[model samples]
Target: MKNAIEISHLTKSYGKNRGVIDVTLNIKEGDIFGFLGPNGAGKSTTIRSILGFLKFDSGNIKVLGMDSVKDHVNILKNVGYMPSEAWFYNSMKVAEAIKYAADVRGLDCGEEAEKLCKRLKLDTNKRIKELSLGNRKKVSIVCAMQHKPKLFIFDEPTSGLDPLIQKKFFELINEYVSDGATCLLSTHVLSEVNKYCKNAAIMREGRLALLDSPDIDDDTFLKFYYDEEDL
Candidate 1:
């Protein structure tokens, strides 16, 4: 199968600190690829490189069969990205932010965005800075999904969301995949991976420690990591 994302010998560093080290991975088209790592394990760095938001010290990255750096603008047009941090103009209303994002993506925000806000129980009229963390997350999701891009890149997408909203997000993701859209999800939630991802890559200490199908049990997988450390 053709890959939606490909990284070959990718490396990045911050001064002397390693951000990523000789990393390589492939996420096939139409697959929901889970990226699991503890905080500061270079998952975000790698994602940024894939999106051409960050430049690597070495190696190559391809997204959707195009050079990551050279084709970023074109690729971004077909990709929906939800960053780890949700940012908005402090004075802008939630509805206004959603509308701006949808417009930038060349999408109509009239019906779909409104329906998503209603389903998430989000108050569209509230200013961004006035909303709670969970509500901010809802606004982000509503905006991200409004355009229905071909590939969705979610960085810690469910953070600050309530359980009910998280469940709804999962349903939305599955619905997208069922319609043949691809997804690359970066998260630490192993349970979510077990329930949703078909395959995953686990990053440890700036490198990929494991990459395989998600059918394996967490206990067994955890044991594998422990054994690797001679524990």
Candidate 2:
């Protein structure tokens, strides 16, 4: 099968500190891949790089079969992204924000967006500033998934969600995966990875520490973090 996401020796530096260094991994088509790491471990850095938000100092990244740097706009058309932080124009209503996102993507997402809002119980009439953190996240989720893109990229997507809502979010993800969509879920939660991911990669200090199947037990999971790679 063709790879959905491929990275090789990806390095990005911020002066004295490294953003990501020599990180290499491949996410196969139709796979739910977990990008696991602790805070400041370059998980977001790698993600941002893949999304073409930040230019890396070296190495290469490919989305689907295209070079990420050169084909970012095209890549984005087929990808749904939920950033680590959700932000919107404070003055816009929830519905307005959703519409604006759809307009920018040049896709009509009215029906799916409305369905998602109802399922997540989001108040579309409320102004962005009036919503709680979790509610805002709900809006972001709808905007990201409305178009039914081929690939999904979620960064700490369930941060402020309540348990029930988190379950709903996972259900939506499962539905997407069931339809053969690929996903890259970046989070610190091990249970989330173990439950959803077919394969997983652990990042430490801007480098890849391990890449393996997610079917391992708790003891094996802990051991990967301690294992060192030559890269």
User: Highest lDDT, which number?
Assistant: 2
Give the Cα lDDT of each candidate: 0.85, 0.89
Q: Model 1, 138-184: lDDT tens per residue?
A: 88888778877778899999989999999999898888878878899
- What are the per-residue Cα lDDT tens digits for candidate 2 across 61-142? 9998989988999999989999878999999999999999999999899999999999999999999999888999999999
Candidate 2, number of clashes: 0
Model 1, residue pairs in steric clash: none
User: In terms of TM-score, which candidate is strongest?
Assistant: 2
- Runs in model 2 lying further than 4 Å from the true structure: 216-231
Candidate 1 is scored at a TM of 0.92
lDDT of 2 at 57: 95
Deviation of model 2 at 50, angstroms: 0.7
- Evaluate residue 27 in candidate 2 and report its C-alpha lDDT on the 0 to 100 scale: 87
Cα RMSD for predicted model 2? 2.8
The global Cα lDDT (0 to 1) of model 1 is 0.85
